[model samples]
Target chain A: MRPAAPMSIKPQADAVQLVLAALIAFALALPFATLKPNRIVPGQPLFLLDGPPFWARALVILALIALATVTWLGCRPSLRIVVTATALMAVILALGSTAGHLPPSNAYARLSPAAGFWLLTGALGLGIADGFARLKPSPLAGLMAVLAAVLILAGLFSSGWLSGISILREYQGRSDVFWREAVQHVWLAIGSLAAAIIIGIPFGLLCHRRPRLKAVALNGLNIVQTIPSIALFGILIGPMAWIGSHVPGASALGIAGIGAAPAFVALLLYSLLPMVANTLSGLAAVPRDLIEAARGMGMTDRQRLWKVEVPLALPVLLAAVRIVLVQNIGLATVAALIGGGGFGVFVFQGLGQNAADLILLGALPTVGLAFVAAVIMDALIAWSAPRKGRGSIA
Target chain B: MTFASRAIPRLIGLCLLLGLFLQPQLFEPVFRPLANTSAPSIYAQAELWSLALSHVVLALGATLGALILAVSAAVVVTRSWGASFLPLSRSIANIGQTFPPVAVLALAVPALGFGDRPTFVALLIYGLLPIFETTLTGLTTLPAPVMEAARGSGMTEWQCLRTVELPLALPLIVAGFRLSLVIGLSTAAIGSTVAARTLGEVIIAGLQSNNLAFIVQGGLAVAGLAVLAHDALTALEIWARRRTRLAV
Candidate 1:
């Protein structure tokens, strides 16, 4: 048999390249719908090659070809490919804007980008990110790219290029109510998180001190966690309603069954498992030697806990807080179902009216809030952790 | 560790399961007092067992789909050539979890035209990240020495992976499955909003009609399912851990 040619250690197309190529191919082959006249109506769709002005279509084709070339040629020009991908994404966004301007003024037609438009935009964004990742760009560089893209999109939005979009129109019609509901959503999430920390920490501490109670307490909490959020809300209503009616001045405090009271209570209960479980684990994790040293130094129980244990446990506790905060932000959306005024009001209303734009209006902000909460909590945990290590040395 | 002691937990679990299924018959007296004066009885409208079964089926379908996708992706990424795609996979999974299921349902309804398909899509997406992360963790953290020994034993790469790595990673992979299953159970209730047959329909009807009995029944059924599933999985995890300990 002829000896096989010595294996040339050539790098094949990596996952990112293959994925980007597939995405671009899918975008090219799919039909891009230019507009939908209303929220419920279906729109006319045409192939990307068939739609848009000649120059715009040419630019898109060129960008796709460049991406394909990079996929085949391998990693040598990844950075340039990323820049091209980012430009392509921006162009797609602009194209979305320009498409909105296609229908006549005073037509009351709502412009909606079709599946292909969304797919192409998403693919381009992912491709850009993948390219940047391959190049090992700084975090700040990624942030700057995102900010620049946002600014360009904002400019387009301000110039009314996307005026015909239904979601934006939904926002414009209910700006006041939107702001009110957003504020309420924040307030509900924050209130429950604060309550959970206050109650859960002490509860956790008690469980930690009494090993016998730990299993029962944790098991109870586990069961609580498993109860669906809606179920918890449902279970709370009767008790809340009874309290509002029977207790003197409770109604004045807004403790009704079908409103914020039940929502708040359910949210607090949901937050407790994470808060308490984390606190218990954090306390348990405090090194035995450190506590013994504190005791040998003649520190009292309260002093030892406050000065040493709390500080040592702070990182884990912060992690719990992070979990609770992010979870509560998501859970509070269900409060709207119970007449607790929040962004969920828009969600339910949209569902009731069969209006997808209104649903997007509510859902996007809720997701954004949850994302922001997660990021902030993560940052806090990272910041607090290193400081504790440094403080122990000092 | 004895049979009787182990049997105790199982017995209790069985009792809980029986009680949950028989809730309408068993709890009728309790619910009768709480029933709204104007509305029809909760159990009269729908069969609780059927709803519970359908809920499980939906969750199972989603969890199974998520498991296959996540495991495939995790396995591929753990391979040397696919390692660079780890961050990309992670971010994609993260986005799946970040988008609320309600929003998913809303957007999907337009394309999928409502019912089980949209709900399935939502659950599939929602369930992907946890399993994916766990599988990634399980595969990457396999004992390096064990893997090396397998390679040294004249095993091919695929055989080493199949025989050495996956067996060791089974417990963690099971943990991931458990988590995704529990999450799927809770999230599947929202499927009713999209006209999918789920326990959420009973709860929604309860809310709309202001019937406390209906709400209680639905809520109790869902809570029971979650608790039972959780306990069963916890048992499985413990068993897997023990088996692995013996094997090692």
Candidate 2:
């Protein structure tokens, strides 16, 4: 008889094993989706076996079991990751197909993902995320994965398969409102960020020029930062309302207490810290010798700032833009509480009506938008960093 | 002079918050004019002290939970065998940043059910990233020679972690904790939408009734509490930093 080889299980497989086991348990224990009569109605859970055909049940379970076994038996990280990702895609496909099984005549009938569905998605996601962490791929690798997932989900949405999901039905009913609010959400986030940059950069420069000013300016900003964002928005309301009514033409310009104006101002205030801090740091990073060389070349301070200093500082400023953009995207949701239209309009409406699907209608997109913004900003920062690396050495 | 100046804002904040909680009527003189003629000048739907108490509970509880989970995760990922988790941790931190606390708090209703529970869960989830990232930095950035010396003295890895690494990292960890607590303080206010009895309840009630006084009261309480908490944490962080230096 051949001697069994010594056990040499890899360490990284431990987390994967746990994820797979949890995935299978969730699949077995809970329903994959709920068959709802309508958006607001609580529905019966469709256990994995009940929702999908025999083929899908077998495929999802079999894939998860195989991955679990392979990891337990020990395998290379890369092989495990590819198999995990493929398995993940398979599970997602299986989830979508479950919707197809629903009768078409039941117009308002929809599939709300139950615990089984979410738990399965979460477990598989952890596996793939674990893979990403372990693989240490290029910096853009994670962003690529995000884009790929978006593409796949987008494809699924466009195919009309997902229309049976409760959240989608909610979207179907208010598709136009959804898009408009999404655009408004983006506008609120970006508009405030733009306003902040215009005000913050020069303020940063002024502070950098005067030592005493930096202390006072940073202290004031710190105080602003410490204030709760919602409170700031609320406090601004009374004053802004007064201005709207008392100040001539303020209402014409949409400068009111409760609308986008106060939300915009509050967001801009929240955004200034990152903007000003980054600008200061970026400008401070400019090499003294380089500035002296610019001076020796007969370039005025303004010329040097606009030309040499600005180019080198571009990356840091872009970083600030990224932070502010992502942050404002999130804060803009709160604007809805104050009658400022954004994704939060759906979220708060959903809350008021106790409709989870409606809230998801608002939240899912806000999260997606913020993440996409982050990835794009990361790419820009990476792009800028390398090109400007040469200047730092000098 | 600098100390007194630095102390003033936090002191005033603490006093204001106390007055709001202990004697809501004291602010009546201030808020009366702001109130509409018919409506009351204070948030009367709930006990001001209890709401304040629950808000503290939510923030503190979430911060504690975050501290344990995040610190453990950081400790694990920094280990050689746990290296794979580093990227997962990084992405989580990144995603946490991308998602607003309000959206996160709202999303919890579906999965966790509404009320304070989901609110606590949301705050816990959101609070994790700051502490985790900061803990990772603290663990990784310790002076190399100090580590070498610890190993030279025959300290086991566990001993080194408990006795040396942790103490050195304490200040940074506290700073991270401070950040989480401050963010949680306000985020919990938003949790009022989900039935969490927070300072936000006051503001929401005010909004619903168009009571300017109630809104101002809630807004001031939350802001004051945040400033007070920020100062408290900053002091703790400085003390921890000083302790480590003194030991060395």
Candidate 3:
């Protein structure tokens, strides 16, 4: 079998990957210009023959074509296309607006060079970083990244049918609304996640030390998790009100079940299981002999925990945190249902109003928040890991 | 014989006691409206059974589908140069896990309409990653020497995988399924909002009406179902582990 020829396929893979990158660039830029001002009037689309003023539309279409071409042709550094597409769209919009032919309604209709661009860029960067993770550029890694990107795009396309397209167009003018809501939504997600991590980590370590306390703590979390979040909020409402009524100090806390407080509490409860369970698991994974060795070295329990156990356990603990963060990023939107206020308001509102653009506006940020957090967490874990030649003590 | 075993029963007894003791007070508000003492309980309706049955059917179907796809992907990626797909698989799986099942529902509702189909599709996507990740992890963790020994015994790749890798990986795979099933149980509640008539509907209804008893009833029903499903899966795990050892 000739020793399998040492498996050299990186160059071939990289070349193909470059083409795919170019194509993706082209794809993003395509709709911006070519999408012509298609206004549907319930039954038929009111197609303006003038159509977004030829020059403006031309610039948009040209940028889109460039993006699609880049996406089609790009290779290993596929995220390059996303950046290229965003830059192209921005330039096109800027240049078109200055020419005085930019349609008033479509002028604010910026080709969202934000969500899709950032997501694709992050994916490409992470995939490449991880590709070299095994100390060699693994072709298998590149392929997987490409396949995932394709799948996400496929899901987007499949979700975007004919009516879906028209619905999205309706919110072209509501860009301001979408942008404001998206920003606040992202902030809420980050704030809640930070609170969960800060509180959960210490709680996890406390439960881990006692051993006897582990079951009760873990089961309590499981029960908390099992309680439908909405019910938990409802359960809290009566007590929050009761306290607000009688307690002078509590009234000042602005303890309302319909806003940020209830949502924050519900999200924190959701964060417990993964955080606590993984913390315990990580602690358990520390080699027993290492603990003995640390003790032999005359290190205190706290010293051993901080210097030895935690460093080793960091990766697993981070994984748990990542799971919780991603989950909360998505679930927090449901908090909008109780008038707690977040991006979910747009999503549920869009649903009620039968407006696809509003739903996309809400959901896009959620996906964006989850994506950004997952990537950052992953990068942090990779960076903190012990380097080569470090003592394994395995 | 051990305190662990004894503790288990105590835990169960405590939960039961809490439920029973709280039931009267909890039911007071719900029953107060039907004070005539003539109305039948809502739990007795045929609708409740249908909802429960539909939920079970969806869960079982999604679970089975996930198992097939995840295991196959795991086996291929773990055993060969097909590992090129690993990053993609991992990322896609993560997306499935992270992609709000609610978002999936909202997006899906437009295409599939208000029903069980969209719910099942969303659940299936959400279900695959944990199982796939665990399967791959377990297979990679298998002792290399054992695999080599099996290969040296003139076994084909397929037979070696079948008789060795899979058996060794069973425990971890079971652990993965446990996680997936629990997540599915919670998420399955969202199906009710989209018109599937699941236990979530009861809970949401109770919430809308501000009825504590209904909330408790809905909450308890879903929680009970989750615990029961988890325990059943645990039993299956035990049985599978025994069977594998028996084969060895």
How high is the DockQ of candidate 2? 0.69
The DockQ of each candidate is 0.53, 0.69, 0.31
Instruction: List runs of model 3 lying over 4 Å from the truth.
Output: A1-195, A227-247, A285-313, A388-394, B1-46, B76-83, B242-248
Candidate 3, A1-394: lDDT as tens digits: 5555544432334432443455445444432222323321122111112323565446655654554454444333445435443443343333323323324566323222222333344444443443334234233444454456556544543443221232244444565776666665665666766787788778878987787788888878876776655456545555555667787876678666455666767787788788888888988888998899999999998899899998998988888878887877788777776556667887777766654556676776677677766766766666566667785544
RMSD of each candidate relative to the true structure: 3.8, 2.8, 7.9
Cα lDDT of candidate 1 equals 0.77
Cα lDDT tens digits for candidate 2, A1-394: 9977766764345653564576668666888888887778788878877677778778887787777766776676667776776677667667777888778998888888788877777777777666666676665776787788789779878988667678888998999999988888889999999999999999999988998999888878877888887788888888889999999999999998778888988999999999999999999998898889999999998999998888888999999999899989989999998888999999999988998989999998998898889988887788777444465454
Stretches of model 1 off by over 4 angstroms after superposition: A1-13, A46-85, A88-92, A99-102, A105-107, A128-159, A387-389, A392-394, B1-23
Q: Report, for every candidate in turn, its global Cα lDDT versus the true structure.
A: 0.77, 0.85, 0.62
Q: In model 2, state the lDDT of residue B92.
A: 68
Question: Per-residue lDDT tens digits of candidate 2, residues B1-248?
Answer: 49888788667768778978999988888999888899999888899999999999999999999999999989998887887567777776866778888888888998888889999999999999999989999999999999999999999988999999989999999999999999999899889888898999998888788778988899989988898888888989999999999987
Chain B alone, candidate 2, TM-score of 0.95
Positional deviation of residue B19's Cα in model 1 after best superposition, in angstroms: 5.2
Q: What is the TM-score of each candidate against the true structure?
A: 0.89, 0.93, 0.71
lDDT string, candidate 3, B2-116, tens digits: 9588458646845653453334344455545522245332433335556666766776677778778888889887766667666556656655666776776666654465667
Comparing 1 and 3 on DockQ, the stronger one:
1
- What is the descending TM-score order? 2, 1, 3
Error of 3 at A204 (Å): 3.3
| Candidate with more favorable, higher DockQ: 1 or 2 | 2
TM-scores of chain A in all candidate models = 0.83, 0.89, 0.64
